[model samples]
Target chain A: MAQWALAVDLGGTKIEAALVDAAGAVLPGSRFRLPTGGGSSSAELEAGARAVIGAAYAALPPGESLLGVGIGSAGPIDVHRGLVSPLNLPAWRDFPLRALAEEVVPATPVVLRIDGEAIALAEQWVGAARGSDNLLGMVVSTGIGGGLILGGRALAGPTGNAGHIGHVEVGGMNVPCLCGGTGCVEAVASGPATTAWARAQGWAGSTGEDLAASYAAGDAIARAAVQRSGTAVGQAIASATALLDLELVAIGGGFSRVSPDLFGFIREAIARRSPFPFVAKVRVVPSGLSDEGPLIGAAALIHRADYRSEV
Target chain B: MAQWALAVDLGGTKIEAALVDAAGAVLPGSRFRLPTGGGSSSAELEAGARAVIGAAYAALPPGESLLGVGIGSAGPIDVHRGLVSPLNLPAWRDFPLRALAEEVVPATPVVLRIDGEAIALAEQWVGAARGSDNLLGMVVSTGIGGGLILGGRALAGPTGNAGHIGHVEVGGMNVPCLCGGTGCVEAVASGPATTAWARAQGWAGSTGEDLAASYAAGDAIARAAVQRSGTAVGQAIASATALLDLELVAIGGGFSRVSPDLFGFIREAIARRSPFPFVAKVRVVPSGLSDEGPLIGAAALIHRADYRSEV
Candidate 1:
């Protein structure tokens, strides 16, 4: 009988679920999602969670054995408390996400973790950093976030927020974040932040895609904005590499693709630490997974269970 | 009848050795040392290693069995290859320190790791961060270095250099390091560096002790220098906490005690990251061990062997 796990992903924008097999493949037609936002009510969220989880589990093959249910949610998540409080979803503060998953799937074990950690596991399992034991998997979309795999195991930390790289202040950056901190990589390098910086510099682009188009058309300000974000990201990566002696960093999301030279700029920042070979040797590359990354990562919470440490 | 391991610590200016029992205690009268500065010839270093090991071994009780030999040396060390090349020790370039230890203590297994890592293990084993599995042990002296224990195990990244926090640049700092990196914690906060900055600022302090005296006397320049270094160290620690989610950081060395309020300054900088609870909550305390920290740390290479991951 084929073995599978019901994978659920909760984010600021939506709740998604899918049936993932032992080999990390998502069962065809098994994926489901429901739109959600900061404005969504608790009753609506509970209904959406039920719908997606049930739909995905219902699609499991007749003879397939369900290993467990794994959930990956946006932070700040307390894996120890099995709660989630996504920054963009003000309606779900410390929501009992794990309990909800368990209520829907009685008699089955449920595992919960931060989405960034799930992504890192997924990347190591079958994405850009395939087979690499030590890597940082990052998302650079509306906000920047990351997860770590060290010595082939996930580092969940005390509260399951080990890889909150977006909040890490980048050296020399002065941008302020809504998180009330200055110089956070998210404040300087996230898609909206990068776009805003470019607009402030008179580029007039209002979105990541618009900025990408402008950059492709050789708009100097767009190029400079992308360069600035990439540089900041590289600097953060370098600092992280120095402290952790990481082997590689796999970055994904909307802004990472804004300019083909984005990675080059990040590399340039890392190069500044050439005197420290360990930091200089760390590799940075685009994330290998597609938009399905979040779901796949959620699935990895179960598929890569051996790599996880208890909270 | 007590089990004991022979411990060795090699540095730029000296080589030391002792016998540490399974209980983590250094057997009285078992410790010995020899001076071997940068100008020491290859013959002098080899003789020093042999003499220290032989003396420590001779002090072993008549009936006690030996566990093994453990060496902690100044890095960049290639633990996998048993090589060491301390930057200040011009005579040893990738010197085979491990082999020499093994040759001196012929029948026992030998383990080698960077000194910083050894200190972290010792701290967790019997020092300030005792039993707190996830922590960083740092030295703030003529130079700055550190080691990490994550999930109750020492994290020796590939190449045995996981916790090199000294080079992690502080946000907004512009100090240049000899390592070719700017704003490195060591460049801005090491004992000599802090003193040098004070001198550059027209303070007459010539040593850490001199600066400490001035700080006691209310000298404004000395106060500023200590504050600057403490803030830089704190910023670096905050960055490290965000990346690693560490629970505690136990610091030691001459400069760490330069002023009673030095810790207050470090805490003040960390407080700037108050928005980040995980980083802000991390505790920073003085080292629980004394000048014997290095020797005990070297012993922990054997005493706390289980905490280490193979390179």
Candidate 2:
């Protein structure tokens, strides 16, 4: 029987639970999802998480002993304390998630990591960054977040916020970020933020999907808004590539799919703006793992023991 | 007899030669200098470097075997080509510096590195970053250049230009960088750039020394310009700290001494603008090696085996 572990990816709107093997391959029919509400209390969220975990466990192969649990959550997480205070989930501030999960499954070790980091680790382990010594995994979804894998190891600083790239200042008009900084990449280029900015500019689009459709229909304002987001993201990446000398950037998440033209524009922007030749060559590509990036990466956090040296 | 290595730090205006021991300490009277001129051809610069190296060698204690030679040059240097194309020394582009130096001191192994990396390595080996795993060493001289040490290794990427922080965009009013980037930290905050910007703003300051005197004498424009440089530098550092999870930034070079109040303002700016709590706590302190940081760090490239892993 194949050994298995429970992988959970927590986001603002939903929680995804899966039974994954060491290779990050999910068991067939072992995936489940649960919705999260804004007004939901911590207890409600915990109950929802338990139900999803129970569903995934029931589908696990017979006689296959559970190894451990790996969790990827929206962060400002304390890896040592297993606590998280994600801004999107204000009610879950300093939430002791690891302990709460342990309450349901006694004596089973649980590892908690940032969602962005999980994506990066997953990429490094079995996806785009398979042989790469240096990699950055970017998630340009509801918000712009990222994770870093350097020297073939996952980078989680003392507070587990090492790969928080969303707030890095990119050149733009000052827009207030949820993290309190102004003109951050997330504020300027995130899906919700870009759509909101486009709507405020009189574009009749309320969602990213609508905006992309309008862009495909040659709506001038919608095209301009996508270009603006792409430009800010490119400019910010040019700076990061220069600073870290990153080998590759794997871009995953929903908004990045708004258009292939966006990534092409990003490459051109970096080429034009980056002062150094080597930095411009830093590849920015799509993550090979799409919906499964976070869950796979969370499992990779435990399976890739070579990554421990970086911590 | 003490084992000594010849350390050469090649800057735009001057080349410093020192007899550095394994511990990166300089011997008395073993320090020598050579002036640089724009009109000087590459051959003349080579002759000048040989003379300085000869002088330092002569001053060293007799009967000591020289282990090797370590050179740190102001960069955009191609380590593979052993060539430099420093903006400050345009005439010396692609100059075969290693071969020329090898001719002067035949058969001794020569190691070449960027001055920024040299300083960072030296700092990591025996200075402020001795116990730290990740640090950024910044030189606030005529130009703002820096080196990065991540995961206990100096980071020199494919082209030996990993930590080019000067080009990292951190918001400066429209000014072109020598590196062809706009709004770069170098364009806004380098010593000469700051003084030039201040003078262009109608402040009666022709030099950093004059600006310091003017700031001390209660000149609002001078103080504002200085403060702006610090703020830009601090904000850039905050972003870099967030991206890399740096532990400390050891600041050196001539302009860093403009005012003690400048550093305090920088701290305040970082604390105010940093989106994450951990990024705000990154320390910005003066260089422990002072004027010798470049030479010592350059020598460290040869002495420290781990430091060579970057190459």
Candidate 3:
């Protein structure tokens, strides 16, 4: 019988649960998903969570041991209290997601790891950052999020916001973030932000997909917008590297794929900091995992218990 | 018998060694120091290390066993390889201070930690941030340097430069750092930097002490200079807090004492980021340990073995 962990990944738009075996694979037919959006009612949210979680438990193979349940959510989560108040889901203020998980899977240990940080754990366990324990994993889609694995351990910090890098302000970039900080990496680099920048620069693009098309066709505004976003990201990464001394950073997400040149621009910006080898030595690469990265990482939180809530 | 570890702190201007008991006290009369300048020849530097190490060994109490040695030096030190190449010490590039200590105290393990990061260990163990396991310790004198105590342990990243915040560029700061990074916290906030800016603004102050005196006497330029440095320091701290989720920050070094208002300016800048509570909640205070913090922290690397060289 294969040892396993039930992994739940809760995002702004959806909730997903799956049984992931020790090898970081999602057991076939074990995955379940449900939409739980920003406008979700309290009752609707719980119902959705129950549906996905119930399916995950039902998929458990009989006689096979279940290690624990790991839930990865959007953060500033109160890991100590097992509560989550993901920014995009304002209706769920300090919602007791852990308690809900416990109710669904009684007597099993339920651990909460932030979704962003879980990605780093996944990358470190089996993806791009597999061989390097000190890594930062990033997602640059509708909004930017990141996770850190330092000293071979995934960090959740006191508030499970250990690797909350999106809101960190970037130098010389003055865009206002909804987080109320000006020039945050998310404000300058996320898909919407990049698209908006291109539109403002007189490009005809209305979305990331349109921007990617224009970028491939060599639209000047589109190319400039991508460079601007990637450069800001590189700047933020340089600051983070200065503080954490990370060995590798893996970038993933929809907007990051808008152009391969996005990475080139990032490298150019980092190379400017070559005066500091620690910053320059940081290897920035595209994340090697598929979309299932977060789920696989959530399971790793339990399966790789030695590095657990350092998660 | 009191258990003790030898601690050596190597800086640009001096080398100091002492025996510190497990209780975090430097054994009285066990401390020794010698001048070691940036221009010192390799032979003179080795002689100074020998002198300090020999005195520390001689001061060790009879019949008491030695716990090992910890060396703290200005970074970027290679903790794993036990080599250091501090910027100011031009002649001692990649100096084998760890091996030198081992030769002086044979059969004893010697661990190397960057001096800036050592300060954080000292703060966590016995200073203002003593009870907070997650903290950033800063020195704001001739130069600004910092260390991180994250999740209750000091961090020495791959290169032993984990908490090297001095050279991280600040968002609005445009000052040029000697390290080739623009607007680095050190270039914008260090004592010498502050004094230079004040002088450029026609303030007659030529040193940090003069600026402090001028500010006390109600000089506008001096006040602005102080605010400039403090605000920059606060900005860097906010960025660091965002990345590390620190609980407290203990600050020392000569320039920090220029005015009580310095802390107020720092608080004011940090308050601007109140939109992010994690960044806003970092408590900045004076160092609780006296000037002996670095040495005590070095000894801590061995005495507090659980937290050791996590230093």
TM-score of chain A for each candidate? 0.98, 0.94, 0.98
TM-score of 1: 0.96
lDDT of 3 by residue, A1-311 (tens): 89889999999999999999988999999999999888998789899999999999999998998899988898778898899988788889899999999999988999898887778888888889878878899999998888887787777777678787887667666676765555778888999999988888788769899999999998899989999998989888888888889899999988989999999998887878887788889999999989898899889788877765562
Ranked by TM-score, top first: 1, 3, 2
Query: Which regions of candidate 1 deviate over 4 angstroms?
Result: none
**Which pairs of residues collide in model 1?**
none
For model 3 chain B, the run of ten residues with the poorest summed lDDT = B302-311
Tell me, by lDDT, which candidate is best: 1
User: lDDT tens string, model 2, A18-103?
Assistant: 88898789888998898875677888888888988778777878788778888888878878898977767777888888887787
Q: Evaluate candidate 2 and give its CAPRI docking class based on DockQ.
A: acceptable
Name every residue pair that clashes in candidate 2: none
Model 3 Cα lDDT, one tens digit per residue, B1-311:
88889999999899999999888999899999998887898889889999998899889899998898988898878787788887777888788889899999999888888897778888888888868878888999988888887787777777678887886667755566666555778888999999999999999869889999999999999999999998888878877777778889889999989999999998887888876776788899988888899998898788766764442
Task: Report per-candidate DockQ.
Answer: 0.57, 0.47, 0.53
What value does DockQ give for candidate 2? 0.47
Estimate the TM-score of every prediction.
0.96, 0.92, 0.95
For candidate 1, the per-residue lDDT at B220 reads 97
